[model samples]
Target: MLQIYNTLSRSKQGFKPIEPGKVKMYVCGMTVYDFCHIGHARVMIVFDMVVRWLRTSGYEVLYVRNITDIDDKIINRAIENGEPISVLTNRFIDAMHADSDELGLMHPDQEPRATDYISQMQGMIGTLIENELAYQANDGDVNFAVRLLPRYGQLSDKTLDELNAGERVAVADGKRDPLDFVLWKSAKPEKPAGTLWSSPWGKGRPGWHIECSAMSCDILGEHFDIHGGGADLQFPHHENEIAQSEGALYGKDRKDDDAPFVNYWMHNGHIRVNEEKMSKSLGNFFLIRDVLKSFDPEVLRFFMLKAHYRSPINYSDAQLEEARAGLVRLYTALAQPAPKVLETALDPNNPWAQRFAGAMNDDFNTPEAIAVLFDLASEVNRAQGDEKQLLANLLRSLAATLNFLQREPTEFLQAGAKDQAGLTAELIEERIAARVAAKQAKDFAQADLMRKALLEQGIVLEDKPGGLTEWRRA
Candidate 1:
């Protein structure tokens, strides 16, 4: 049985989906106002690992991640750049896809857009108003009646009496209470082209809370198994979702027929920079692309999993460089030539892979799993005559099952920027020329030196049945 840390229960609960052979998962996605950062990658990669392990253990997982195409941030960014809101969000969405692809996150089974589900959102808002769960003011702005929803503060552990948002109460004719959040914000005359939809209340845009509710219900069903996001979303966002979803279903008088919403909730820890909180005001934020320019994706993954998913990750250049160096050792060990893989499950004469599997099975402890990988590397480097091939094959086969060590051995051994072999054809030609000059001048010493340097850097030279020195990345 697989056990997972459920944030809702705050425990490692056994995973049993409502359906027999399937699992449903929903992850809150990017707002599409800016490039994705390492914090976003933490959530994405953590969930990707979750899905991968579920599939590895024989569960059919239908993963859905939503794109918040419309939000205050998106509109402001549009205005700042002098572009249409649609154009701005689309550009960021494309950037999101590229970054997700680079970081190795699996494409979600469904990616619902907020703009496409405004009708559903409006319908939910109307139900809330009818059931006294919400109310609309004179200005046509609808707000969620927090006091009416008895479980308003349950998810965030806040009390209804002390609901403090640190913002002053505004005098709006439509709102009955101050704690009530806007379910639909009435479009103002000044902002003509931001976004708006016709609802019972008035022409307005859906609030942040309603977007997730409508999108999740529309795609995954009225109820689903898991709802996950960053740790920061536990409060108002998720709290509001639980209220609107369950309240709407109950208000329809389908108490029993109401689909049970997310049975489990999961959240990954935040990413910090050098132990300092990464924020725009602090000027310490780094986009994932900028970080990727200096480091390999796998090294970043290893760095992330080094700490438990629930623990904060402190990012720094030194930490990533160290991870890269350590990763090289393991990948190189697997990248060595593999003999024929044995058909059946046996001891395999190496305990590293078995140790890895056992660690992975125990509550998806990737840190422990990675420790096993390091142990395998230690064993490989220490092994002599009889033990080498068995350990190498074990590492290769295990990595095939778990994608942590997939790169070819040559690629794995590369350490620094210098490890990149021959950046251009001109560099290759120059290196070749140096080698030829050394050999022709009878300075065989220099020629042999250049060849060894190239080989060490992962450039394999072949004196192929052709008279030319053929070269390729190993």
Candidate 2:
């Protein structure tokens, strides 16, 4: 059985789906105003690992990661770029897919866009109005009444008084309370044309927080098995979701008859650089595309899994280079050919597999699970015949659960270096041939010089038995 740390409970608990053998998970996805940064990468990769593990654990998972295609950021970006909102969003959406493909992320089962559910959002807002949980302010904006709902700060574990004192909360003119958040924003005269919708509150758009509440409940029902996002969202965004969703479901009386909005809440920690949070405003943020220019996508993925999901991971060239070196070792062990064997299920009874499963079960502890892979790799290197083949298969199968080590070892090793350097395969082969000739002629100094030149170009040569030599990227 898998145990996950529930952010709401602040402790690890056994995972039990509301429906046996089934899970409905909703994760807040990208805003799509620009290219995804490393922070966004963490969210996508973390949840992708979770979904993969659930399916591997024999549960049917309905994964929905919603896209915020109609947010204020999207609108502003479209205006700045002088493109239609759809045009801007569609471009970034394609870019997001390219990035995701490069990173080897499994697409979510359902990717609900915010614009597609406008009617549902309006309906939910009306329910809040009818129950007096929300009200139309003098400025024609609809706001959720935080004071009206008892236990408003349950998720953040902060009282109304403390939240009021927090400097982050803005006191707008029309809002009754400073802590109250907008459910619907009235259209401004300068707002984009398509951005506004005719709602009961007037011509306006759904607020950022309300979009998720409506979309998640509309797609996954009023209550679901799990809700996940980055830890940054736990305070205002997710806390607001809980308030609005549960308020609409149970009404002002706040009865507990029906199911809770979400059974478990999970949050992945942030990515840091030099012990500071990685943010574009701080000049420390790296775009996924920018990072991929230098490091392989698999290397970035491995770097993230090297740390526990809930722990902060630092981003640096040194860290990525280290991860690249580690991947090379894993692939090197897989370079040797193994005896052919019939396909079979991953043996849960196998000790190594069991150990891997145990680490994964204990809150998706990927670092420890990766250690198990290294152990299997050691065994694969030492064993021969069927034993070696079995260990290699086990290594591949377990690593695949975390979406790693799927490429052919030699191909992965040899492919990328040439791209990094201004060299071609033909050039590398010619150099290798020259080095071989020099060695055969016993020109030891010439052969050594040739090797040094190739090494400087990021190509490494390995001499094997029977006068055979192989080369790969450094």
Candidate 3:
């Protein structure tokens, strides 16, 4: 009963998988020329949330996120680094995995590298050529004929004339039309050695857009349930993907065969800093590894889920600190002494769980769902005895769907910022002991001073009913 916002339809619609109880989804992944930035983080985290919710909703998902290992960027970067294309791509792919692991992203069911599927791409391009949807230009490059596909701009909601007039489409020397995009690029004499592939269109490589069309159809089938990527790709990249995938099917003489390239399209909004887009060219981008130095990985994840997936999230130190503080509150509630919890499965019948599911079902509205988590936390804090234990278990179960709150509350609460030096556990225990001694001596002022000192070091102390004290980092 989950409804998602489909970018193609430009509205929220009920999700119905092509198969009854299974979903086949393809998401455009990183280009892998450099380390992933915060923008890339949003794509990974957003789709991860979607997949987790789908599994929690009891549907089998075949998630395929493709890798662009043989793009122009990769070639140029390898040239600059004075290394082979394979060496450059493999190093960045490993770095990307490390970043994904740190962000708690589940590995896609299939990660097809573009370079590994050259044969399939060539075959698809040949099909388009036979169908007359694609043609080999005078320069030996094969380009998709955009004018032949009447629905070319449907995905981006822009007409061909609009795209052509808004920004002057550079009519490449050999292209017949200005709007036509290359399906295969011909190798140039000045190009690097390993960059070229023996293709039907001469020794060249696949174009940027053709890689996804070939890989997605080959792995997930010509038609799948969902296709996702960043909003920046909505224009030429995804629009061209739809054109090539569908145009290859019924070129020119179009028919309603009830088969489309993809059913639902989902796009995560950009990451902004001070009302400007976060990008390397703007010098405002931060690498995932660099951000993890100051904030916990879980804190960064929490910060992302705080906003709706489609909404742009502004990154700043203040926002991250606020996220850490909010996460501390949730962990604090969980750290309360209670009986052991065994069952963690979500019970949709439970009223709290019902509210949470309702929020999640309505277009994956994470902000609303997160509000339910806060409300549950408040309930857990207010209740007592077995009631508290039951509610705490429910809180953990719900958070697990979002891929967080799995850590022991005390451990997470006591752990300080990753790169900063805070009060150590031993030092904190000593301070607590000194404060206890001061209290026993009736030196209330001395005890209060010790308490303030620990608080200043980002530590919070709680006095239990039986003269026991608990300490956690704030």
- Which sections of candidate 1 miss by over 4 Å? 167-174, 252-260, 338-354, 383-387, 400-402, 418-474
**Collision count of model 3:** 0
- Report the lDDT of model 2 for residue 19: 91
lDDT by residue (29-127, candidate 1, tens digit) is 989999998888888888888888777667799999999999888888888898998998889889989988887768999999999988999988888
The digit string of per-residue lDDT tens for model 2 on 1-474 reads 899999888899999998999999999999998999999999999999999999989899999999999988889888998999999989999999999999999999999999999999899989998889998888888999998887778778888777762566666668888888889999899998799999877899999999999999998999899999999999899999998998998877876565778989999999999999988889999999999988899998999998899999988988998888878878877777632333324578889889999999999999999999888888889989777877787788788888888888887788653266777777889999999999999998999999999899888899999988888888
Q: Give the per-residue Cα lDDT of candidate 3 at 401.
A: 90
Q: What tens digits encode model 3's per-residue C-alpha lDDT throughout 332-425?
A: 7888753254444678789999999999999999999989999999999999988998888888889889987888888878875763455678
Full-model lDDT, candidate 3: 0.89
lDDT of each: 0.76, 0.88, 0.89
Estimate candidate 2's alpha-carbon lDDT, on a 0 to 1 scale: 0.88
TM-score of each: 0.84, 0.96, 0.96
User: Whose lDDT is higher: candidate 2's or candidate 3's?
Assistant: 3
Rank order (by TM-score, best first): 3, 2, 1
Off by over 4 Å in 2: 165-167, 256-258, 338-345, 416-418
